[model samples]
Target: MTTLVRELWESGYMHTQDIAYIRPDGYIKITDRLKDVIKSGGEWISSLEIETILSLHPSVADVSVIGVRDKQWGERPLALVVLKPNAQETSADDIKAIAEKAVERGIIP
Candidate 1:
C-alpha cells in the first residue's frame, strides 16, 4: 500500500482507487467505487471528488465524469451533469470553476 501511495504521489497518474484492489478472500469483485482520475495540464484531477461536490448542488440531479481533450492541458475534466427540473441560472462553467475549489485530494487542479 505504501508503494502504491508513493507512486501516486510521485507520478500523479490515474488513481488505483477507481481501478481495483485485492480482496481478503483473494478474489475480485465488482465493487462500487469512484471513477478514474483525469489528468489536465500536467495536473491530476480527481473525478470522484469533483462529482461528489457537483452532487451537492441542490439543482443537480445526476452526473457523469469523463476526460475531454484540451490543447494545452492534455485532458480536462468535463462534467456531464443532469439538472433538476425548474432549476435555472446555472452553467457548466460555473460547476467547473466551483469544483476546482471543493477539494485538494493530494493535488491542486
Candidate 2:
C-alpha cells in the first residue's frame, strides 16, 4: 500500500495538483493545474489552455495567463505576453485574432 501511494504521488498527483491524462501511446499530457485555473462567470477556465493557444501566435515568444478580479464575472483571464524580437510592432488586434481563431476552432472556450 505504501509503495502504491508513493508511486501515485510520483506520477504527478501531489503538491501543485496538476491534472493530466495518459494517452494511448503511453504519453502523459498535462491539462491544467488547480491553483492556476481562472474562475469567471461561475465557469472554471484553464489558464494553461489559453496560454497554449496564445503561444501559437507568430508574435508571441512567451505568455502567462492569470485571473483578474471583475465586477460582473467575479474574475476574468488576463494574458501577459512577450513578443518575439522582430514582433515588437504586433498590434493588440493581431494578438486577439489568434485567440479568436482558437475559439472558432473549439480549441478553447
Give me the candidate number with maximum TM-score: 2
Stretches of candidate 1 exceeding 4 Å from the true structure: 1-35, 103-108
Clashing pairs in 2: none
* lDDT of each candidate versus the true structure: 0.68, 0.77
- Residue 20 alpha-carbon offset, candidate 2, angstroms: 23
- Compared with the true structure, the alpha-carbon lDDT of candidate 2 equals 0.77
lDDT of 1 by residue, 7-108 (tens): 445576644344466799997664654547788877787777777888887788987676666667787776779988877888877766667566445333
The runs of at least 3 residues in candidate 2 whose Cα sits more than 4 Å from the true structure, single-residue gaps closed, are 1-34
TM-score of each: 0.57, 0.64
Model 2: how far residue 49 lies from native, Å = 0.6
